[model samples]
Structure formats: structure tokens, C-alpha cells
Target: MPRSALPPLPPPAHLRPWLDDAVLRADRARFLTDLSRRSLGIGRLLLLWAVAAVFVLGWTFVGMAWMDVERHEFFSYVHGLIYTVLGVGVLIPAVFWLVRGIRQDRQVRQLLHAWVESDRDPAADARLRAPGLSLVWLLASFALGVLGLWVAFGAAASAGPSRTTSGELAYIMGTGQILWITGLLGLAKAVVHYRWAVRAFRSRN
Candidate 1:
């Protein structure tokens, strides 16, 4: 059998010094590069993008509560409290992960830059480019946006304006809006990643 392409992962943490040595840093960067490739692989990335919809779902309830408050509806305060609780439950983790990802990306870039400059590792550059991942992101984002549009607008079109109750209409509208906006977010993410990948490829060449 052929040998594995990736470098072995760094040793157990207890073996490292107070600050990372060059070997440790390069090994860690290589490990993270491998992880990034796995996470951004087509099927896995698509699923990860789909999970982003939960953010829209949480915000939908918050919007519903806001509308209720604005209209002075009977359940305004109670629904607002309940919706706020539910939204917060979802949002806290969402925010946590968002912040974590940002920090991780920064650290990964810093380590990768140092490793590449010092070691002249070509595999790291290739992995960072992530050849097909950007195309997958673009395709997935487009598909998601199309689905969102159908969900958000199809309800009214099918039910007709006069047939649906206010609550029913609101529910459908909110769900649809969530899907549509989530798709937009996915598209934005795709664009950003694609641009970054393009730059990575150019830098490699």
C-alpha cells in the first residue's frame, strides 16, 4: 500500500514546552490543514452549511415576537418572553461557535504562514487552496437559496390570500423567510471562501 500523505499529528500536549517549538508548531499546522480539508470536503461542508439554518430559525421566533409587540397583540408580552427564551437558547451556542471559528481561523493562518515560510512545505499550500471545495460551496449555496425561495413564497401562492388564517399565514411566512435568508447567508459564506481559496491558489503558483 502507498504511504499516507499527511504528516503524523503532534505528540501529546504534556511533552510540549511552555511555548511551542518550531517542530511542534509545524506539526500542529499540518494537522489543522488536514482537518480543514476534511471539514470543507463537499458532503461535510454542505451539511455544515445546512446546519446554519438553525440561526435563521431562532431569529424567526424573535421576529414573530417583535411583530406581536408592534401590533399590540393580546399575547405580545408573554409570547415575547417565551420567544426570547427560545431564541436565546439557540443563539448562545451559535454565537459561541461563530466566535470560536473566527479565532481558530486566525490562529491557523498564523501557524500555517510561519510553517510555510520556514519549512517551504508545498503540501500545506496545496491543502490550503482546497481545489474543489469552493465550487462545492458555490453550488450548495445556490441550491439552498433556491429552496428557500420556494419555501418562503410558495405558501401564499398555494393557499391564496383569503384562505389562510392570520396565525397560519404568519407561521408560513416566518418559516419561509428564515429559509430564504439562511440561503443568502450561505451564499455570502461561499463567496468569501471562494475568494480566499483563489488567493491561496495564486499564492501557491
Candidate 2:
């Protein structure tokens, strides 16, 4: 009589680095705390950006209306248009990140629960430690940075002698500066994420 043996199961695809049971047991509390901090940080950042966007939008509209009424000029309309577009450009990504962060917070909580239930199984731990960066997010970050730069440059160029008045120069410069700073910040974030991704890949390989 002959007997057959079952084939070995494949490892989890999402398994990541730093999933050892000892590490998990030692750092579980800190890890959860860090997750909470990240969630709260993201929430605060989103709220701040949302408020800023609203303020900018309101200022653009009200200022444009006032300018049109007082000066009888179309330049205000153009300025409003540029500011609105840039504001929206930044707002959209901020919203996306906010939503994503909320979802990630939930996911991490579930993972924490699973890890506890599983007694910190290696596979579960690996799943929890899996890298979150994706091509879509990377591309979006890059696009946001580019858009910010483009808006900044456009704002600055629009303030040139032929198109704008002395009174408008300050507004244009302020808008450009805001956009440039935001763009640089976004780029820096992207770079940091990209480095993390590289490290994750290297570890996995």
C-alpha cells in the first residue's frame, strides 16, 4: 500500500519585513500608538488644509467681486480663476489623502485585532507589516507636486507688467509663494514615500 503526501501551502503574498513574533510582541503597543498618532495627524492636517482651501476660495470670490464692482476690471476675474483652480488642485489630493488615511486607520485596527487573535502568527504579522505604497499613490503624489509647481509659475507669470497692475502684484506673489511651498512639500513627501518603497522592495527581495 502506498500513501500520498499533501503539497506545501504557498506563503502569503503580502508578507512584509519586521514580522517576527518577538518583535511584534515587544513593539505591539508602540506600533498601535504610532498608528493612532498617524491617524490623528492625518485628520488634523486634512482639517487644516480644508479650512485653508475654503478661506482661499472665499477670499478669491469676494475679492474678485469687490474688484469688479470698485475698479470695473476683468483682471480680478482672471485672478479668481487662477486661484480657484490652484486651490482645487491642492484640495482634491488633500481630500483623497484624508479619505485614504481614515481607511488605513481602520485597516490597521483590524490588523491589530487579528494579530492579537492569532497570537501574533508570522503570516498575520507579515500581513500587518505589508507595505502600503502603490503605483497609483506614487503617481498621484508626483502629479500633485507638478501641478503645484505649474500653478506657482503661472501665478508668477500672470503678474507681469502687461497683464497685472501694481495693486495686484502682492496678491500674485502671495499665491505663487503658497503654491510653490505646497508643491515642494508634496514633492518631499513623495520622495520620502519612494524611499520607503525602495527599502521595502529591497527587504522583500
Candidate 3:
């Protein structure tokens, strides 16, 4: 083909205007807003778990009180039934929601990566950093794990000598185990976030 008939070339880097600061700021803001909205769903799921845990504790206390006062056979059965139902009803849905949130978060991350790749602007890197767990959260998780283990072991040690009823002891142990598990999960999550943040910082450098 004749040179004059050839397609035009893309504008050179020096010839193109710099991406506007205002536009960049707007893009960053929009990205953060979307992320926050998505994260809110996860927060709600966690909140549900908290509420369910509170309910379980409350019922356990009531059941213990009933046992101490007068162990009615029918009431005992009813108490166990309610506890089982509430535990299953709440935990199952909470777990389901948690899994869904995780999947959604992964999808959002992929979308964010694609967005960054499309722009290829060094300035955008600052805005592209993934959210990580805070120091406060890490400390809280560790503390909770330790406290839970302490409670669980303490109850086990005292149960035999204190002559505590089997039902009450079981409840205490279960609560402690739940707390310990949750705390460990939190700690793991914090560690993952820390590692990811470190990798991102290194990549940026």
C-alpha cells in the first residue's frame, strides 16, 4: 500500500495530555465507594453471627438457671431442643453468607485488577492497594484466642472439683471452644492480609 494510505499511528506519550488529576481522583473515589458497599455485606454477615452467639449464650444461661432451680424433665428437653434449633438455624445461614461474600470479594478483586491493567497509570497504583487488616484487629484476635483457651481450660479444671453439673459444664466448654475457633480464624485472616499488603508494597517498590 502507498504510505499515504496507511492507517494513522497512535499519539506519542509526550504528545498526549496527562490524565487529569480531577479525573483520577474521581476514579479512585468511585472504586473505594464500590468496595465499601460490597464489604458492608460481609459486615452484615458477621453481625448476624455475633447476634446468634449472643442468643446461644443467653439460652444457655437460662437453661442453667432452670437446672439449678428445679430440673423439670419436660423443660430440660425443651431447652435442649431450642438450643439445637437456634444454633443450627443461625450458624448455617451465617456460613452460607460468609462463603458467598468470599466469592464476591474475589470477583471484585479480579475486576479491580482488570481496571488497573486497562489504565496502566503509575499514579493509580496508590489507589489500587487492597484493604488489609488493621493492627487493632490483629491484637484483638490474638487476645480473644488466648482468653478463650484460658476459659476453656479453667472450666475443665474446675468442673470436677466444683461439682458443677454436666449440662452447665458442657455449655461452658462449648462457648469457649467457639470463641477460640473464631479468634483463630480472625488471626489467620489478619495474617493473610498482612502478607498480601507486604507483597503489594514490594511490588510497588
The most accurate candidate by lDDT is 1
| lDDT by residue for model 2 (1-205), tens | 1122111122233553436756545455445334433433344344434543544554454444444444555785666566556656655665676566456645644544433343333443343332343333345445655665666577666676777754355444445444444445444544554564355435544
Which candidate ranks first by TM-score, i.e. highest? Answer: 3
How do the residues 1-205 of candidate 1 rate in per-residue lDDT, one tens digit apiece?
A: 1223433434445665654686665765656565465445565455455446666667667666665665566778788778878887886786676566556545545444444444345555566665466667667767877886787688767775467655456667676765666567556656765676676556656
Per-residue CA lDDT of model 3 for 47-143, tens digit only, reads 5347436645554654455454345577776775665666566656656765764676566545444443333455555443434323544676678
Q: Give stretches of model 2 more than 4 Å off.
A: 1-48, 51-137, 160-162, 197-205
**lDDT at 34 for candidate 1?**
58
List the global CA lDDT of all models: 0.61, 0.47, 0.56
- Give the TM-score ranking, best first: 3, 1, 2
For candidate 1, list the clashing residue pairs, or say none.
none
List clash counts for every candidate, in order. Answer: 0, 0, 0
Query: Which residue pairs overlap in candidate 2's backbone?
Result: none
